[model samples]
Target: MSEEPPYVVSPTADSSSTARPATFIFLHGYGDDAEGLPLGLAQQFQFNNKMQYLKWVLPNAPHNHEAMARAWYVPKALPNAVKPRVPGHEGEEDAPDDEVGIMQSVDMLDQLVEQEIKNGTPSERIVVGGFSQGCAVSLVWGLTGRLKHQVAGVLCLSGYMPLQTRIQQLRNERGIKDDDKDPKRWFYVHGTMDMLVPTRLFVQGKDELAKWVDKENIEEHLYQGMGHSTNSAELRDMLAFFEKVIPE
Candidate 1:
């Protein structure tokens, strides 16, 4: 069978001639197309015009399971029926190839960001973010691997690290000290009641991640009563966080 083409959502600014100051690349969760959550945020923020200075690109994940549904990779089925390892959860069987795919996504994103920069977007103004499975990939790529290009920050919503053991491997391979204080660059957002991924995973990941980086570099926000989805409050807080990290 021929390979399915990748997808990207391009929301342009009011003024087409001027280059945006930065770009935000959104990676969607499993079974979700690039048009959902990211598009919601792009509209909410009116990022195309309000932040006319910023360019928003939402890239759809590859089609899997013949549904044209998006996913970073084929997920490993889970043991507990209540906690199915379908799309969002990070289970052990998901280690090997998922890790590789996450890195590949980062590289691909880096290239896209570089192209934007060459077109007039600045490196320090770029941001990467996503929800659920998308968030998991963003977290792993932001923390473990080195970007060929630097971004302003990363936003990981309702997601957790996939492979915990790879922390040391990532550090050893990339030569990044656990305590290195460059700047607070990673943001973790989750609903306290999100049963899909569970808030506990974030706690666990953070505890382990602390061994390699300053806790300050990672900012966490818990939304009470929210589930595996994003609410208005979450979006507002996310926009606030973005302002702090990528101020014009």
Candidate 2:
């Protein structure tokens, strides 16, 4: 229903450098548009000198007429059941089951990566990141893009693993060996008070990921009194993570 561009780009701060720049692709949460928060942050925010070499791409999710929202994929119609449900937290959203639609969005993200590659950044220099629904899409794509290249890092903000139920099948389809580990570095940051994805879901996703990814390769940060949204401290830590993985 709304009209926004397909994507927004924030050029690197140090454009004077001739060497290939790193690219950080960001996807927005459900019902949100990239032209708003993501793009504005990308254009204005800088953590440290390490960010100077990072170019940003924030893409808008395709509109969903059924939900009347801009969503990466439609949320599951029914919430999932939790065993031994917590006393006050029995209700949680178990989303990211839309394989077909998630993959389609991955394909779309792949195009952005391909373009970045053509422009100069290699696959290893690219990072995939997102918030909430965007985070879910990025996770599935980072693991199963058709290009078959492991990206440098993934930034997950207040989100859970979408295809948690089908992770094994996804691994089999991608020819991933049980003992094989990926080159991608994962950084997961969540609010302890988050209600949307819930801390339990984060634990579930983290456990599932540890089966395939080494514990050393993943970093997690939990913020108290925070909700589904991000705050200054989380952003600072994220910048620190980027500095470690991809230096300017």
Candidate 3:
């Protein structure tokens, strides 16, 4: 129905607020909510003990009729009969951009980062990440949020960026600098056989990311034979990325 408070994990779920040294706000794929990503992660890896000091914030996408489920925004090309498309190939990529809801979602997620700051963690210690649809929103927010420069890193897992044609225009409107030498770290992971965000879009997303981010600051990996979802190897890479960006 409505967006609720995020699912939070502070230190050990019982630690004090002051114990938080870094934060990771991860978003879920379409149809998933605050509960999904963590459950999925737990099934894949046991990083909670190692990442105990990092505060975790998982937000849910609001429900909407157009999405037919929870989603960051409604895709312009709605799915046909049988099953709802999960925003991959099909006509979703080439359709005229539906950006109204995208911008709104960006703003909401930015507020979540701001609230973390108000709670004592600096933006430099914050890492925003997501799966599928959530990854798209996280990347957009990192690039366009008013506090963009202050944030630490972005984690994109098997996702593609939307508004590719309009990103530069949006940046110009927001007065974002064309070249900021000290860009935040970014990790991008996608499956080679991913039809959801197919290879064409994946390459396109990387090229788009290169425009704003330094090539050296971005880490990319393409898993062989993997599909739309993640694997144990991907989870290992995630843990390593977490260590690199949010080190203790």
Model 2 per-residue lDDT tens digits across residues 48-111: 3437767788888878764457888765532432222323323334434668878778778788
Off by over 4 Å in 1: 1-20, 47-50, 65-68, 77-97, 174-181
Each candidate: what lDDT?
0.68, 0.73, 0.77
Comparison by TM-score, 1 against 3, better one: 3
For residue 89, model 1's alpha carbon misses the true position, in angstroms, by 12
After aligning candidate 1 to the native by TM-score, how far in Å is the CA of 124 from where it should be?
0.5
Candidates in order, TM-scores: namely 0.80, 0.84, 0.87
Residue range 36-102, candidate 3, lDDT tens digits: 8755574334354666667778888888666678888876542231224544534663576558878
Candidates 2 and 3: which is better by lDDT? Answer: 3
lDDT tens per residue, model 1, 1-248: 11343343354454554543667877888787666877777776774354645567777777665323567755543223234444454464433535666666666666666676787766778788778878877766676546522677888898777767776786578776665544537778788887777777777766765665567777788889998899988877777777877775
Would you list the rank order by TM-score, best first? 3, 2, 1
TM-score of 1: 0.80
Clashing pairs for predicted structure model 3, backbone only: 88-196
lDDT of 1 at 114: 68
Model 1 clash number:
2
